[model samples]
Target: MARYDVPAENHDRVLELLRQLAEASRAEPGNLAFDIFEDIDDPTRIVLLERYVSRDAFAAHRETDHFRDLVLGQIVPLLTSRTVEQLDAEDQ
Candidate 1:
């Protein structure tokens, strides 16, 4: 699984774009799960949870053209900061 902690002042503006990304991601072949959450304490903060069948799936997503355009062209500009974490599931 990979997690993203994102803090932004413009969450409202990106909601539509994020929705699009979520829809696209969910339809991908190797996607196991994908979600978005907002912090109750701070609406500006969002959490992104993504799971894949394997690391190869994650890598494939990174290389996709949509992922690059969304991050580099859309979401990156709207974010104040983004922290990412990758984890290995012990049971898997």
Candidate 2:
């Protein structure tokens, strides 16, 4: 699984975008899970957790038009700062 640490000020707008993004991912072949979490300490901070069946599935997801649009178009412009972490059970 991977976690995207995203920060944005446009609360309602960002949530709207997230709703769309979540809906879009649900139809993808490799998407095992897709979920979003809002940080308790900071309202602006959002975490996106993505899970896939395999590396190939992850690659396939990146090629999808919705993914492209979300990364290149919507997220980049909306986020103030973002960081992605590949989470592992051992890390905890």
Candidate 3:
């Protein structure tokens, strides 16, 4: 999961970039899901939910061209802050 606090001036551009990122990420081999959400109370806040088949798959995702170009190169620079966390599902 990832959370981004975008500057007001950059919010729209950030959202556009995120849409492209989600599209590319979802097409990756081990990607299970790539979802984007907006914070209702805070229009500048964006959240991403990313899922993969395995740890290695997640690592590979970080190494993708689209990830580097769109996320690191473009979207990241428009944000005031960014946070990422790794999560796992509890066994039933």
Q: Rate the local accuracy (lDDT) of all candidates.
A: 0.73, 0.73, 0.92
Q: Is candidate 1 or candidate 3 better by TM-score?
A: 3
Clashing pairs for model 2 are none
For 1-92, candidate 2 gives per-residue lDDT tens digits of 43334555576677787778888987898887888888798777777888777778877887989878976678757777667665432424
Predicted candidate 1 versus true structure: per-residue lDDT over 1-92, tens digit per residue: 32334456577766666777778887889888778887788777777788888889988877877778876688878877777777665664
Best candidate per lDDT, number? 3
Best by TM-score: 3
User: Which residue ranges in model 3 land beyond 4 Å of their true spot?
Assistant: none
In the predicted model 1, the residue pairs found to clash are: none
TM-scores, all candidates, are 0.84, 0.79, 0.95
Task: List the candidates ranked by lDDT, beginning with the highest.
Answer: 3, 1, 2
TM-score of candidate 1 to 2 decimals: 0.84
